[model samples]
Target: MNRKKSIAHKLLDAIGLFEIHKLIAKHINQHHADIVVDYDLSLLRSAHLIGAPKIGFFHFRPKRFRNGGTNKLRRIGERLKHYQKLVVLCDEMYEEACFVWPHLKDKLLVLPNPVDLDSLLKKSACSIDFPENLTPGEYFVSVARLTHQKNIHLLLRSFAKARELGCKWSLAIIGDGEDRVDLLDLSKKLGLEEAVYFLGYQTNPHPYLAKAGGFVMSSREEGFPVSLLEGMALGCPIISLACPTGPTDILQNGKLGKLISFTEDNPDELGLAMFEISNNAALRKNYAEESKLFSQNFSSQKIAHQLMSLLRDIASNQRP
Candidate 1:
């Protein structure tokens, strides 16, 4: 089930809770399915109401839990004792979950998010025209939903400053979301109309990923950061905000990619980082080499093994 910090969120959850999941859980249970992997926490309550054992697959850092606020998260964390297991995307999240509900610590599993490297390679081979006035291997790319949590506003401002500081690369953002209008407005406000190219949503952005000279992520927070991992898989050097539960772990604290501290509304740190990453060819070379190795750890085979093992354990422990 979804958990939110504010009563307003709780009200919203109550209004639009799960009629679909409830029906699907019934079908799965009737068919003798032993477990439901809860990708979206919105369905956890329905899974249990149907008497199906669930493995909570955490895809985002729970805002209330990650930032250490409110009683709502504690209630949700305490409810973890009822789940078959909790699969977190990184060690920091695993620890955070344990801290949230110490008694359910044994039920927590650390599984790095996996990417389809082969699919990326396949898509990269496809022909796609670059945006007008764009050059391959001469710009920064970011792939994320244009939402408040992603903080695309921070990215535009940093890019503007980086431009002022003589960084020659342009920016291409992939994906669309609620913040698109606001972010585009900010881009123009910062006088970045020519330097930034908003590509909207692309079904296969691998061509952009492959040709990118570097990548940058300025999210306010994240759980796993799939975009950053995809960049590494394609051998594009990266710079990211040191958002909890992902970037620091993936970048090995700046050994493979640059991680800047998140300063509220101030793009100075990330702007400086962008300029440095653009100018340093040797560092970029080393980062590219190191990131290639780093990307291997999130292989589908490896993560699938862990997930399968959890499934077996849950199936075996069921009280028939």
Candidate 2:
């Protein structure tokens, strides 16, 4: 799923998917299922075989609809016509989808990811060994994979610039990925060896999120990031890049948090955001309160009710 496959590999994957679909279809028929929901949109061809109304959900920004060649996008649009409805994570994506396939505008739905606020709050209270050098409410924290998409390198560069600008807070990154070594190298190259701590992946990142001075997201793209919502639920002041698809919606165009944009060669805007958040206590408190209040709108119960209503309508052969 990461890259293009050889023709032989593609053929094998297609055969395997067909078998899986057949088994799934048989199970649905035996169980008298009223609807079929595909999270990956791979079941489009198998919808008729399953003999049930089908819904497709995709979480990430689909690269095909954006940058993929014209022929591939046409094929994707054709495949999408089989679904009773398609759910995307944010309004920006909904607009993009409608623009790409105006014919299926009525079939598109915007549904942000839900966060279990109560559970996250409870988890944030659990006792864990925190770093001794970093004070709870004085260090910036980020929880994301160290990947090109997450853009940890930009964070490191921004942290460096913030440090030069007299921002005293250290940064704690709480995830791991293939780009770990490169990110670490960049951190050292920027002379942040002592100021930036790579805590790697944590089974429970909520404690860190709950106690940090600020939560920062530097992703290049996102589909309604759950981590951002978790940070909000934990009442951390937020600083996120105006990335594709999600951050703008989550931050409410910078009302709920500090939103910054950056170019490939310049991360000064992000640096200034970090510096401002570090220096201004009133700003942090205001953003934290607003973020906590806004996060309640995305609670599990509320979003679940909306989803259940949609499923019930679809199940009853009604358009939603």
lDDT of 1 by residue, 65-146 (tens): 4344658777676556667788888877777677667787788888887887778779887999778777887899999999
> What TM-score, computed on C-alpha atoms, does each candidate reach?
0.86, 0.92
Alpha carbon lDDT of each predicted model: 0.82, 0.86
Question: Over all chains combined, what TM-score does candidate 1 have?
Answer: 0.86
Any idea what lDDT model 2 has?
0.86
lDDT of 2 at 24: 73
Model 1 is weakest, by summed lDDT over 10 consecutive residues, at: 61-70
